[model samples]
Target: MKETPLCLTVGHLLPYSMTDFNTTDFTNPSTFILLGIPGLEAAHVWISIPFCTMYAIAILGNSTILFIVKKEPSLHGPMYYFLCMLAVTDLGLSTSMLPKMLSIFWFNSKEISFSACLTQMYFIHCFSVIQSGILVAMALDRYVAICHPLRYSTILTNPIVAKISLAVVLRGGMLALRYPILARQWPYCKTNIIPQPYCTHIAMVNLACADTRISSYYGLFVLFCVMGLDVIFITMSYIQILRVIFSLPTKDARLKTFWTCGSHLFVILAFYIPGLFISLLSRFGQNVLLHFHVLIANVYLLMPLVLNPIIYGVRTKQIRDRLFRLFTHEGA
Candidate 1:
C-alpha cells in the first residue's frame, strides 16, 4: 500500500489519496479552512489593525447618516431615501465580512463549516449586487430631478421609491441566491481550503472536484446583466444630466446642480471601479499576483463603506448642517 502526500496549493484544494478521495462525500465536507492573504500569514496581525479601523468607521459613519436621514424631515425626499438605502447596504456589506475576517486575523481561527461558508458567500455577493442597484436608483432620481424638474415629484413619489428599493433587494437576492445552491451541488472532494480571507462564489467553486464552467458563466452573466447594465444606465442618466446642467442660463444653478450630484458621483465611482477591476482581474488576470487580487477585493468592500458617509457629510449641505446642529445642541 502506498500513501499519498497532501499538497496545499494557492487557489486550490489539497490533493487526497485516490481511493479515499473517490469515496469521500462532497456535500458533507466537515470543515473548510480559510487561508487569509496567502504568503503574508505573518503580517495578518498588523493587517488587521487598519481593517478594524475601517470597519469601525463604516459602522459609525453609516449609522450617523441613517440617523440624520430618519430624524431630519427635510431629508424626506427621493434622493435622501436612496442615500439611506445606500447606507444600509454599505452596513450590510461591511458586517458580512468584518467579523469573520477579524477572527481569522486575531484568533487564527480559519475553520468554517461548509454550510456557514455558503451563507456568508450568499450575503456578501447579494449585498454587493444590491448596492449597485441602489446606485442606479440614485442615478435615476438625479436624472428626473435635473432633467425634468416639474415631473420629479410626481414620478418619484414615496411609494415609487419604496418600490424601487424593494425591486433592488429582490433582483440582487434572487440572482445571488443561485450561487450558493449551484456551488453546493458540486462535489468538493479535492481540498477544503479557501485562499482568500472570506468565502466568495468563485473561490469556493474553484475548490470543487467537478467542472464549474456553468457556475462561472452564470456568475459572469449575472454580474454583467445586473451590475453592467446599471453602470450603463447610470452613464446615460449622467449624460442627460450634464446636458441639462450646461443649458441652464445661470452659473449658480449649474453649480448647485453639480454640488447636489458630487457626492453621489464620487460614491458611484468608488463602488464601481474597484468592483469592476477585481471582477476582471479574477477572471482574466491569471498572471496577476494573488495578493493584488486580495487587496483590491478588500478595497472594493471597504471603500464605499468608509467614504460614502464622509462624502455626503462634506458635500451635502443638508446633512452637514443637521450634523452640526445635532452636535451643537449636544454641546449646549
Candidate 2:
C-alpha cells in the first residue's frame, strides 16, 4: 500500500498463484507424461527387474497352458477352453502394460500421445472385464460339472463355450469403449503428468480440467454392473455346487468334487479381492499414498497372471500330469 512498485508486487504474488500458468487449452495437449511411482523414481531400475520377471513368467506360463490345451485332445472340454480364454486375456493384460511400464521404469521414457494412452487404457480395462467374465464362466462350468453331472456335456458344449468366450469379449469391449472416449472428450487444462505407472480410466479422468463426476460415476457403474455381478454369480454357483457335493452319499465323491474346484476357487479369490480393493481405494481413499495405489494396482494385474498358471499346474491333476509327461519326454 505504500506505493510498492508494480513489478515488485507482481513478482511477490507469482509464487502464490494457484492457477497453472502452463495449463493449455483442452485440445492443445498432444501428449501426457506418466510418472512411474511418484517418489521412487530412483529405484526404477531395481523395480523393473521383478516386473520383467513376472511379465516373462506370465507370457511363458499362459502360452504353455494354451499349448497344452491345444495339443492335448483330452483337454478340449469347456473348462479348459475357458482356461484358454483366461490365458489370452492374461496375455493381453500383461502385454498392454509391461512394455510401456518397463520403458518408463528403465529408460525414463514416459511421454505418451493422447491416442496411445487411450488405447492402452482401453485394452487394460477390456482385458480386466473379460477376465471377470471368464471367471464367472468357469464357475458356471464347475457348477454344471458338479451339480448336474449328467448334463454337463449338453450344457457346455464346444460351440457353447466358443459362444460364451465371444460374448465375454464383446461385453468387455463395449464397456471399455466408453471410458477412453469420455476421457478423450474431456478438456485437460490441468497438468498432463499422470502420477501412476500406466494409463487407467480413473487416473486419466482425475486429470481432466472439467467436472469429472460423470466419468467417475459411469466407471463405478460399470464396475458394479460387470465385475460385481460376476462375483455374485460366482459365489452363488459355488454355494450350489457345495450343496450338491454335500448331498452325495460317499465321502470320496464329495472330496473329489471339492478338489476339482480348488484351483478355480484360488484363482477367483486371487483375482477379485485385489480388484475390489483397488476399486474401493480409487473411489474413496484419496488420502492414500500414491505409491501404495500403484503397487496394489500392479499387484492386481501381475499376481493373477503369475499365480493362475501355477495354481492350475499344481492343483489340476490333468495339467500337472501332462506337464510332467511333456518335460520327461523332452528330456528323453
Candidate 3:
C-alpha cells in the first residue's frame, strides 16, 4: 500500500498533523490544540464539574433576570433596562466560552480551527467590555436616582437609555475587534497548543512567532480605557452618592440610600476584582504555574456571570420579591 502523510485541512483552514511539523519553516497552523489546564489534566473531570454547574446556574439565573424584568411593568425603568443589558451580556459571555470549555474537558475535543478560535476570543472579550460598560451605566443609574432624584427621569429617559446602550455595544465591539484582527495577522509558527482552555488574546499572542509588543501595549491601553475609566467613573458616582446619603439628615434615609446601591457595589467588586487579577497575572505572573493561571482566568470569566444574577436577585427588593413570587405561585 502507498504511504499517505498524516496531515489534514478543511479548505486550507485546519491544522496540519504531526507528520507535517517542520522546525525550519515558520508557518501558521490552521488549528490550535487547547490544553485544558496544563499540569492538571488528570483532574479535568473534577474541575469541570464545578465549571459546568456554574455555567448552568448562570444560564438559569440570567435568564430569570431577563424574563422577570421583561414581564414586570414596574421594572420598565432605566435601572432595570440596564440590568437587562447586563443579564444579556452575561449570557453572551458565558455562552461564548463555557460550552467549548466543557467540551474540551468532557470529550477531550481540544482541536479548534484558528478562525473559530479567533472568533471565540473576539466574542468573549467583546462581551466582557460590554458588561463593564453596562455596570458603569448601572452605577450612573444609581447615581442619578440617589443624587438627582428629581431629574432622574428627565436625565435617563427611555431614549437616553437606548442611546447609552447603543454606545456601549459599539464601544465594546470596536475596541475588542483589534484583538482578533491583530492575532489573525500574526504568524503562529510556534506549537499550536494553547495553554488555556479558551483562546485569550494573551494566549494566542504567546503562540505567535512574531514580536508581540504592539499587541501587549494595545492590551494595556484597553485595560486603561475600559476597566480603568469605568472604575473611575463608578467610584466618582458612588462618592457623590455617598455624600448625598450622608447629608440626608436621618439614619433611616441614609440606610435606605445605602441599601439601594449595595447590589451594584457588590456586583462591581465581583466583576472587577477577579478581572483585574486575571489581567495582571496574565501579563506579569511569570512565576505562577500554568495551570493556576488557566484556572483563575476561567474563574474570572465565570464568577461574574454566576454571581451577578444571584446578587441582584437577592439584594434588589423588587427582583427578590418577584423571584419569590415566581417560585411560590403568588400574584404578579
lDDT of each: 0.81, 0.80, 0.81
* Cα-based lDDT at residue 174, candidate 2: 93
Tens digits of per-residue lDDT for model 2, 269-332: 8887776666566556656665776666677778898999989988888888899999999999
What's the lDDT for residue 249 in model 1? 93
Error of 3 at 169 (Å): 0.6
CA deviation > 4 Å runs, candidate 2: 1-27, 279-288
lDDT of 3 by residue, 155-236 (tens): 9999999999999999999989999899989987757876668777876766678888888777767777667899999999
How would the candidate models be sorted by lDDT, starting from the highest? 3, 1, 2
Show where candidate 3 strays beyond 4 Å.
1-26, 279-286, 330-332
Worst 10 residues of 1 by lDDT: 6-15
Number of backbone clashes in candidate 1: 1
Q: Which stretches of candidate 1 lie over 4 Å from their true place?
A: 1-27, 279-287
The predicted structure with the larger lDDT, 1 or 2, is: 1
Q: Which ten residues in a row have the lowest lDDT in candidate 3?
A: 6-15
Q: Cα lDDT for residue 237, model 1?
A: 97
Quote each prediction's TM-score: 0.90, 0.90, 0.89
